[model samples]
Target: MKKIILGSLFLCASTAYADRVDNVQTEGVLSSQITMTVADITCHINQGLGISQQIHIPTISTNDLRTGNTKSVEVPLMVDCQASNDQPGSIAIHLVPAGVSTVSGDHTITTSLDSVGLELAWKDTSLPALIIGNTEFTPAQATNNVWDLSLIARPVLLAGKNVTEGNYNASLAIKVTYY
Candidate 1:
């Protein structure tokens, strides 16, 4: 019988793969971290939405503040720096006055009509009196990075009292720093 039917069909395919079986399971693990920084210099004031710039003192007549005659307005300070290789260092300017602090000490800065106050000079009169919160160090008439400041806002009569006609305002804040 053909060699006993091929030895019983190879013994039923080796007992059907020796009754098969296999199973596995195992999992977990992952991570991360990074940091960076780079800066040589950068500055932007009066042109960075810091209220841009505005000053307009004209109509004054408490007999022109009793014959002292005052009226000055021109507060323009534009600083734009970006140094890396051009090397623009040394620039510190800060004049913050949102009112109050007037007896004319820190160069006045208080107005809403209370004997009127607003005197912050530096029209090249040896550049030095712009102190309201103090942080002066301005001497950059023409650097490649730019820093042009020619400010003067006068309308002082603080403490002379009794010169109120109503409606007078003052508010200033400009701070720039670079090393």
Candidate 2:
């Protein structure tokens, strides 16, 4: 009788352990993926100079009028990204002008204006981050899932009466990253 009782107890313990192991093995695997896409990316400039000759903007048309410049021209840039299973995604835009130092990177514009005594300035007075919308995917904390971003750059030309007339050119680069 004693031997039978001991055998029964061992059998019950083994069955319980097997059931626990089986439950763990049946648990599903957890996994995720992330992806980003730029739905539409474009840029344009607006000039504020009053004199046509002083307003020879390059991003748009050569024939653009410079008369009655109200505010410096506004350049608009758009970017879009999407993620499948990722948490955060971010993008950085770099604008570099010809003859400017690449070391400065995205901090400043290096292109030289032909017009003498003409002052050029960026509209980002507050130096605020160019965020797409209020949707959150900012340069700091990028939003999860799909994000749409739009940014505008304003260029103001402070030209004197004796400003020179010529064509100015610059280049910009846009980069995106995900984690």
TM-scores, each model vs. reference = 0.30, 0.34
lDDT of 2 at 169: 46
> What is the overall TM-score of model 2 with all chains considered together?
0.34
Candidate 2 yields a Cα-based lDDT of: 0.37
Q: Point to the candidate with the largest lDDT.
A: 1
User: Where is model 1 poorest over a 10-residue stretch in terms of lDDT?
Assistant: 19-28
Candidate 1's displacement at residue 55, Å, is 16
List ranges where model 1 is wrong by over 4 Å. 1-37, 42-62, 66-69, 73-94, 98-108, 111-114, 119-144, 156-161, 164-174
Q: lDDT score, residue 113, model 1?
A: 78
Give the Å error, residue 81, model 1.
Answer: 5.3
lDDT of 1 by residue, 1-179 (tens): 86788888888876765656333233556566667435565556556655355566788888776566887777777666644443344666677766544435667677777788877776656344556444444445546666766578778677657777776887766666655
